[model samples]
Target: MKPSLQLKLSQHLTLTPQLQQSIRLLQLSTLELNQEIERFLLENPMLERDEPDGGEYASGPTPAAGSAQDGVNGSEQPSEQDNRDAAHEEQQGIDWSDTGSAPGASSTRDRDNDEEVDFQEFQPAETSLREHLDQQIALSQMCDRDRALARLVVEALDDDGYLHQTLEELLALVPAEHGVELEELEIALRQVQSLEPAGIAARSPQECLGLQLRAMPEDPVRKLALTIVEGHLELLAERNFARIKRLTGCDDDALRAAHALICSLDPHPGARHGSDDTRYVLPDVVVRKTRGRWTVGLNAEAMPRLRINQLYASILQQHRGQGGELPAQLQEARWLIKNVQQRFDTILRVAQAIVDQQRQFFDHGAVAMRPLTLREIADQLELHESTVSRVTTQKYMATPRGVFEFKYFFGSHVATDTGGAASSTAIRALIRQLVEAEDGKKPLSDAKIADLLGQQGIVVARRTIAKYRETMSIPPVSQRKTI
Candidate 1:
């Protein structure tokens, strides 16, 4: 085949580094953005956080050079030489504030106040499951070999403290030359299981329950609980009270007591000692009802206040045209700042649009939520549907009804008798209400729930209702029915 160069005319879109950064920042959640800012602060010397009491320098638009007299204490206007310097600085990606305040120009008192405000008290670290087990093992009287084997077994156990691997599988892990006998491994397993949190090192759910049952005080109920765990687990799970009664020969009160005891046992005993790191969701935007109108605003605390490092910019200004890494770093810092600002601006716009569309939800809860879509918000905000999707993915809004993800407001529509569409979220809310108010002895079936919704104007299928019910972790009528 002969190769020939041909000029082909085509049109395509390309994202600049700044545009790519903007897209990335827009998609990131508040936590992720904060982490990204921290990373940039570390990598780029020309970027720094605008501290509070840095005055107007912390926020607002960069002032025009001609308006220098409007700054703090009527600062003197720059001369021709100073203007040249300022222009040079601007060219180097330095964004000077309108107030004309220099970077780190805040008084000592202001700096001290900022230090006090930014100080966060340290929290004590939580001990993990393995750490807790190791502490117990350390305190026990055991030889080196036994301790090592026990440590291996402890390490092999999963987060739930269940040994998913068989003894044979674990035995294979040991070196052949070590000649670790199965009896020694068994002893080690027993030693580890004998530690605190009664059900650790259990091979199965049955064994886990058995361990907890054995730890309980001796009682007739405990004995029956042991029997139930041993052989009648399936019957118990099915709530086949008749079969269980026939097999155990226990009366209503006795069986109930045994069941209650079994319920009290911890199926996952090691869960208590697991990692206790609680993740807190910070809303990116807040929606409020003001003077009979819905208003949306960004969460100030969630946003990282970023600014160009005036000190670095000044240094670059001093060495003009000495092209090196400084200019690249300066450009990068400028891009990051502009991208971050654009990200939040886009988020605020999208959030405001969402609040305006879903005002009914804020006023009357989830049931009042109207059917919304990404395309609707995207069209209203003049943004791409993918951009809207990214903005909604991890972003959250604090509303009168509570915090919710941006995506929570957008749901598929269900046709109604009134020729209007109701949000699937509204339908799910109605389902939840019906289930919550249902009589325990005769829980409402999915079909009954559908019928009730049909009567209320919203049309939904039984399968959809069941799916939403399961999504909300609600059980079926059969499982929900009380004795």
Candidate 2:
């Protein structure tokens, strides 16, 4: 084969730098988008945020570079040298000495200082599970070698408080010179398990339950619970009350008490003392009702208020064609401002369309949520399906009832007896209601729930009911029944 040069006359879609930035910004969540904006502000000096108190950036036509002169109001506009002098003053510290005493300025500073102090005092410190366990170990009265071994065991425990490694495995981790043995590790393990959380270092679910049961007073019920945890844990999980009774010789009332007590114990004790990081969700759009009409608007707090730095931009325009990186930076700044505006516009439009389609949901909650899909919204808004999916990925809307992700409104349809379709969300909500209002003495089974839904014009299967019930963390009828 010989190498030859050939020209193909075919056109293909290509993503420019600006287009790629727009796509990346569109898919980011509110928090991520704000971080991206901050990065752009740092990298590009020509881009700066508008005043927080000022309204959002105007989505109308972007003014020409020559129109920057309109920003100066006085008859004698400031010259280039005056602008440079002002920029220099801003770069340096503000000269409060030259400004003398200004009215209302001291009051503003006092108010800001007071707010800063309050925020600093209320801020929380993050602490992890290992740190908490180490603190408790420090206060314990243990010898040096035992304390070191206990620290090793504490480090081996996972986030769920379960010790996945065996005693031999942990012993191998210690240096031989320390003369650590399996028996010493076992003692250290018990010492670490004796922390505030009753079952912090158990090896299995049964052992975890046993540890908690042992912590309680020796009563008939507690003894029965301990026996059940020691042996017959599988039968207990299967809700095989008859078999458990045969093995433990407990009556219905005693078995019920033991089962309740077991359920009350924490399965993952270490989770209670885990990381204390809090994530706050900020809705991208705010939906409200006005004069009996539903309306959707952008959340000002969540949206990034960005604008082209008029001073820098005007200066660059005056010195145009003096080849350097200034022209590229200015162009990049314009692209960012336009892209941010476009990203929010797309979000607002998609949110409005969702609210319009799922108006019943806003009016009557999840039960009234109809069957919707990305294709339907895309077709209605004349956008690509991928674009719609990107818009709904992490965007959230604050409705009258509560906040919900944009994708929550889209679900598969379930055929109904009335020749119409019902949303899977609505079906799940109905199942939850049926289970909540069920009789404890005779809990409704999956088949009965399916039949009830069938009578209500929704045809769902028993297995589907079971799946949704499990998804909602509702137990089986056997587990839900009472004496």
In order, candidate lDDTs are 0.85, 0.86
* Residue 468 Cα positional deviation in candidate 1, in Å, after optimal superposition: 1.5
- In angstroms, the error of model 1 at 150 is 4.2
lDDT of 2 by residue, 1-483 (tens): 999999989989999999999999999998998888889899988777766654556433334554533343326768998799778767886776676633456888888878778675677765677888898899999988888988999899999889999999888887888787789899999998888688889999889989999988999999998998899888888778888988777899999999889989999988977775788889999999999989999988887767666667677778878737877887898888789889999999999999999999989988998999999999999999999999999899998889899999999999998899999999999988998999887899999999999999999999999998998899999988764
- State every prediction's TM-score relative to the real structure: 0.78, 0.83
Candidate 2 — what's its lDDT?
0.86
Best lDDT among the predictions, by candidate number: 2
Give the number of the best model, judged by TM-score.
Answer: 2
Given candidate 1, what's the lDDT at residue 437?
Answer: 97
Task: Write candidate 1's Cα lDDT for 216-263 as tens digits.
Answer: 889899999899989899888877777888998888788889888888
The TM-score, computed over Cα atoms with residue i paired to residue i, of candidate 2 is 0.83
- Lowest-sum lDDT 10-residue window in model 2: 65-74
- Give candidate 2's total backbone clashes: 0
